[model samples]
Target: MGWLLMIALAALVLLALWKVAGFGRLGLQLAGAALLLAMAGYAWQGRPALAGRPVPPPARLELPESAFAQTREAMLGAVDQASFWLRMADSYHQRGDTYSAAAILRSGIRAHPRDPDLWVGLGNALVVHADGMMTPAAELAFNRAAAIAPEHPGPKFFYGLALAQGGRFDEAERVWLALLARAPADAEWRPMVVERVQMIEQLRAMQRARPTR
Candidate 1:
């Protein structure tokens, strides 16, 4: 908005110059027209959204794509368990088939509705499926996980990443910072959580400095 105002002021100066100057009238008119066009562009860029919204960036996950299946299976166990199903879903997710990952989680939920971890996994898959947009279903999935297991870090961690992906960096940072406070001193995932929180803080600072578009 400030940039647009600055451009508008510059255009007014050109218009004023055109009125005062005997020669170079044509040049002044052309320059004023160009400045007006630039102001319009600046105003458009400052708008929060356009008629057709752009696709958001994809969400980031702590587990690298390669670690999805093998790591989870080795650490969490077999197919009948919800964690195993989460691993299977993650395997699909790693291949860019978020729909398949979501489907897997839905099936896992049918068998293990009480499992908060499965709910969190579904939320993560849904966020990815939506290209990092926080759809109502994804929000519900995360909320369900939090309700089922208030103390669990899985939902908050993944949901924070989703929030960050959607350009809600402040909210993401708040969620992560709170989660970090609750993390155990010797928790294996603590370092990763701390790292993510710090990253979000840096991202928030960058966002503040960035011009809106």
Candidate 2:
């Protein structure tokens, strides 16, 4: 679908150039067409990874299973509304297709750019795609989410998770500490964040104790 749209668009652009310019300065017109075609080719080459195979069969992804729903009430006000697409993305992540998961979230962002939850979802997927490493791209996603929804706890929590996964426990702890301080006492995700902070502390201690070979 995406490719076909791009091809159609390229043809339209070429046709418009032909009709408007009438091949006057034919070299420039041909160059424009060539550039459009090249772009289409590049998009097609990357389509497989960008729009990969179908995500895991649709299923209700639970909270504790992936920690995805931990901050559900805070993030999107609940799990069943616009967050349904987010759950689908999480399902892909659970099934080990982080690329597809990220792609789905990206599509969601394109339609709803201001939705911080989608940005956080993309960040989470990127973290998984990097094998628990928080790559720069993942960081950017988190930052975008945070910038868009400065008061939202989802971005901070997931950014911290990514840091912990990348073995940057101290950074993760700091992020989580700030989140905990601001998080409502009755918030459903507070306990989960506390649990993860404790886990990170323990992991940091162990890493410190392991003497270099």
Candidate 3:
């Protein structure tokens, strides 16, 4: 908004100079129109308002056309049926199609039990479906993947997420601390770990303040 205001002011000065150079009243009118448009655009952007209540940017959908496009491209030259199934599962996962994603990954796993990626995908799908139930199924799926590829971070992260979402904060804390220890000090997941730890502390404090049930 500030930049737009500067540009509009500059244009206004130029317009005034051109009008003074005998360009006629028509050039002045066009300059006035341009100034109004720039000012209107700046106002609509809502960054500098006298009222002090800035409007927020538009909310965007979680799943968008580009994610779908990527899925389409992934499917185009899939090496095998398993690859195609996995790509389709990824598309379903991106769209929050947990059941479909799990089913597809399960099929891929049944076809190729040795595929660590398939197991990891299945585990992630199960975690998504777990929501609040924290069912034994999700635990088993993650455990299976972790057992197959114990060094893989994907299963561990999902397991920690599942523990956190299930409200087992103590267990989640232990798991996340362990993950952070294994993960690099400057891992990209550091912020997420910090935030989750803060959330856990806040919730625990709230629980302590509540009356006994």
Candidate 4:
């Protein structure tokens, strides 16, 4: 019964190719031969009687949005033209659509070229889109944000984050150290930076202690 169904399906496919796909006589013959060979191989090795098993979906890598949003608000302030665009991009980022998030940030940057927050957001989106690698464009975006607001913590903090994510721990440490040196004692985001720096130090120590191949 299973063999009959397979043959019928193959025949229907060949007929469709001949009629709808405009296969010539020679092409139809070649396709038929290929189908026969496939059937023979299946008969020898395929297991048609096995029960189907459900496959769990692969895990998705995503940003921690709540912590991210809080940090952004703390560093860049809570309201502005850039804030609207950042929120819109965050919605897309939360949905695992990093491309759209980056695109939206690009649009926002075009409209407000000197908005440091938007540039930082674009850098972040681009890094996430590239699966945590800090691409040249993302680096450019972070640099632009820093150039626009020399004193802003958002650019340096998030740039260091992208560096750390890409395993450039030394560079991340330098960037965060500079930020910490200038950051005020009572700044809301200072604690996060301190924690991240400590984490990076621990990671560096672990790497040093790892057994070499």
Q: Can you give the TM-score per candidate against the true fold?
A: 0.58, 0.60, 0.50, 0.66
Candidate 3 has which clashing residue pairs, if any? none
Candidate 2 lDDT over residue span 142-168, tens digit each: 999999989877789889877987888
Off by over 4 Å in 3: 1-87, 90-97, 209-213
Candidate 3 residue-wise lDDT, 1-213, digit = tens: 677667778676766668667656687777667777876786687565456678897653354322222332222223355466767876776676668878998888888886655665565567666654457777777788788878755556667666776678788788877877887777655666667677888999998999996
TM-score of candidate 3 to 2 decimals? 0.50
Clashing pairs in 1: none
| Best by the lDDT measure | 4
Could you tell which candidate, 2 or 3, scores higher by TM-score?
Answer: 2
Please state the error at residue 164 of candidate 1 in Å: 1.6
Q: Which pairs clash (backbone N, Cα, C closer than 3 Å) in model 4?
A: none
Model 4, 38-136: lDDT tens digits are 999998999988999999987555666833465787767785899899999998888777899899999998999989989999998898889889999
Model 1 poorest 10 in a row by lDDT: 67-76
Higher lDDT: candidate 2 or 3? 2
- What is residue 115's positional error in candidate 4, in angstroms? 0.7
How much is 95 displaced in model 1, in angstroms? 3.5
- Report clash pairs, candidate 2: none
Native-structure RMSD, model 2: 11.5
Ranking by lDDT: 4, 2, 1, 3
Q: Rank the candidate models, highest TM-score first.
A: 4, 2, 1, 3
| Pick by lDDT: 1 or 4, better one | 4
Q: Candidate 4: deviation at residue 182, Å?
A: 2.3
